[model samples]
Target: MYEQFTKPILDYSIALVMFLLLSPVILLVSILLAISHRGNPFFLQERPGKDGKIFQIIKFKTMRDLTDVNGKQLSDYERLTLMGKIVRKTSLDEIPQLLNVLKGEMSLVGPRPLLPEYWTLYSEEQRRRHDVKPGITGWAQINGRNALSWEEKFRYDLEYVDKISPRMDAKIVLVTLEKVVKRHGVNANNYMTMEAFKGNVA
Candidate 1:
């Protein structure tokens, strides 16, 4: 009931209100990011949505297009700037994804979408995580985010799919807020984010 109806309504309202209230902050961040990264303020990447449909996920650009002497792209740690780090730690980088929620491409709570290429690697059970719209934050995110192993994260995601309820969603939102406020689990220890999934468990 909530997931199909009320959540969407509430998500839309929140998206609109947040976008309006944060416009000034977003604009300021955009200016700083443009000067710092010398490109658009936002980043967009294709991620699989419900039922494996594709959609463009949006966020504030936090990494530079830095290259090595051989002209190869740099790693996340290499490209992540100090200002970018601040944006990421504060989760200000995710503000743009509110537009994604507004567009019906995301929800306020569900499994965080992964790269499309990962679709091939997911087991049938793991793939069930996409049964609902992807979220800005989710059970997996609130649990440990980058701190959890890929296996654990997927388990949490599947659990969310099985037991989604307004009460559960509300709990996830609260825990996510607390985690972000403390800047906890912003990055995996010694890694910019979780290591890329390599289908190692297969």
Candidate 2:
């Protein structure tokens, strides 16, 4: 009952409020990012949403365009601009995704959407994460985020899909607040960003 009706209502209302309240902060960040990256402040990419539907997820640009002598793009660690580091570390990069929530392409809470190219790689069980709208934060995010292996991340995602409720989401949100403030588990262990999931091992 709640999932079908109330959740969407709440998601929209709360997202609207948040977007308004955070607009000033968002503007400030956008200005800084523009100066640092010297291009569009916003970043958009196709991400798989509910039932595997595709939508453009919005975020702050956190990397500079740089290539090596071979004309290949540099690594994440290399492309990260100075402002990008601060934005990424504070998770300000994710704030722009509120636009996605307003557009009904996402929810405030659910499994985090992954790259569209990974769609074919998802196992039957793993694909279940797409059963609901992808979120900006999730159970896996609070638990370990990029620190968890693909297997572990999928486990938590599936668990949330099964147990989704207002109470559960509320808890995840509260804990997410704490985690964000403390700047906990933002980066994967020993990697500039979370390592790619190369598909489940046989």
Candidate 3:
């Protein structure tokens, strides 16, 4: 009942409230990122949504487009600005996703949309993670995020899809809030962000 009906309505309402309540903070960060990056404050990338639908996911741009002398791209750690690190650590970078939820491309609680390139790489079981709209926070995110291996993360995503009870979502939400407050696992141990998923686990 919650998944098919109540949850979407509730999620929309909550997103609306969040958008209004946090508008000032969002605007401030947007301006900060724009000034720091000298470009668009928000970055949009196509991600596979429910049933493999493509949707543009929005996020605050925290990294600069710094290239080396040969024009080779710099690493994330190198490109990440001090403000970027602060935004990422506080998860203030994700505020724009409220707009995505408002646009119906997402839910408040579900498997997070992954890179579109990951579509071709997913095994049948792994693909089940996209059975519902993506979310800003989810079972996998709260559990470990960058700390977990790709296989473990995908398993959590599929697990969330299979058993999407309202209680479960509430738990995920609560845990996500706590993680944000604690600023845990915001980045991988040796990477500026979680390492990109190369392929399905063999």
Candidate 4:
């Protein structure tokens, strides 16, 4: 009942409130990233949402585009700017996603969205993570975030899907705030991001 009816109201109201409250921080980061990259500070890319629907996920652009003499893009660690590092560590990069919530493309709590290219890689069971709208944070995020292996993350995602409720979501949100405050599990094994999910995991 909560998932189908009440959650959407809560998500929209909370996101609107948060966006207004954080507008100053968002604007400040935008200007800083714009100067740092000398280009657009917003990043948008396609991610699978509810029932594997495609939607453009929005975020702050925290990496610079730099290439070697061969013109090949550098690694994520190499492309990460100082400001980017701070923003990512503090999770300010996620501030723009409030717009996604407003657009009804997401929930406040559910499975985190993943790259569209990974759709084919997921087993039928793993694909169940998309049974609900994606979230900016989720069960896996608060539990281990990028620190967890793909299998562990999927386990938590499934658990959430099978047992979603307002109480569970509220607790997840509270724990997520604490996790963000501590900057825990912001990266996988100290890397700038998690390693790409290959089909072998399934």
Candidate 5:
């Protein structure tokens, strides 16, 4: 009952309310990102959502388009500006994704939407994460976020897929708040952000 009807209703309602309440902060961050990037403040990229469907995920532009003399884009650490790091650390960069939830492309809680390029890499079991709508925060997010290994994160994603309930969702939300408050696990081990997931090896 909850997964079929109640969860969607709650997701939409809560997303709307949160977006309305956080509009001021969103606008402020957008302005800051615009100044930092010298242009658009929103970053839009195609990500695989539920059922492996593609949707453009929106996030605040936390990095600038900095290029090396060779005309290649710099690494994430180098492109990440001071304001970008601050917004990312505080998680203000995720505010734009509330619109994704409002648009029905995401949930407030579920497996996070990952890059479309990774579609071919997920094994049959790992691909189960796409069975439900992706989320802004999930079981893996609350557990360790970028700090966890890819295999561990996929394990949590599948676990959440097996157990989708209001109780589980509530617990994830509460823990997420704690994580953000403490600014924990925003970066992967030794990387400014998570290292790209190379295909799992045998």
Candidate 6:
């Protein structure tokens, strides 16, 4: 009942309210990012969504397009600017994804959408994460986020898929808020971001 009708309605309503409430923060971040990125404030990338459909996910531009002498882009740790680091640390970079929720490409809770190229790398089981709309935060995110291994994260994702319910969603939402407030699990211990997931090796 909730997943079908009530969840979408709640998602849309909450997304609209949150977007309006956070408009000022969004604007300020956009302006700062525009200045830092030289006019581009939003980062858009094709991510696989429900049923493996591709959609352009939107986020705040938190990295500079700096390149090496050979023209290869710099590493995430290098390209991340001062303000970008702040925004990322505070999770303000995820604000734009509310728009994705409003647009029906995402949900308030679900498996986080990953890079499209990774579609081919997922095991048949891992690929099940895309069975529903991706979210700004998810069961994996609340559990350990970047700190969890790829296998562990996918286990949470699949668990969420199987046990989705209003009670479970509510718990995830509450825990996610606590995690965010504590600024926990935002990045891996030795990486600027979570390490990319490679296919599981035997």
Worst 10 residues of 3 by lDDT: 193-202
lDDT of 4 by residue, 30-141 (tens): 9999999999999999999999989999999999888999999899999999999999999999889999999999987899899999999999999999999999999999
lDDT of 1: 0.92
Better of 1 and 2 by TM-score: 2
What is the C-alpha local distance difference test score of each model?
Answer: 0.92, 0.93, 0.91, 0.93, 0.93, 0.91
- Provide the global lDDT of candidate 4 against the true structure: 0.93
TM-score of each: 0.96, 0.98, 0.96, 0.97, 0.97, 0.97
lDDT of 6 by residue, 81-122 (tens): 888999988999999999999999999999999998898999
Backbone collisions counted per model: 0, 0, 0, 0, 0, 0
Find the number of clashing residue pairs for candidate 2: 0
Off by over 4 Å in 3: none
Task: Rate residue 48 of model 3 by lDDT.
Answer: 90
lDDT of 3 at 115: 92
lDDT of candidate 6?
A: 0.91
- Model 3 per-residue lDDT at 12: 94
lDDT of 3 at 32: 89
Instruction: Show model 2 residue runs off by greater than 4 Å.
Output: none
**Residue lDDT tens for model 3, 1-202:** 7788999998999999999999999989988888888889888899999899999999999988889999999999899999898999999988899999999999988988889998998898899898899999999998899899999999999899889998998899999999999998887789987888888656
Off by over 4 Å in 5: none
Report the lDDT tens digits of candidate 5 across residue range 47-130.
999999999999998898889999998999999989999999999888899999999999999998999999999999999999
Worst 10 residues of 2 by lDDT: 185-194
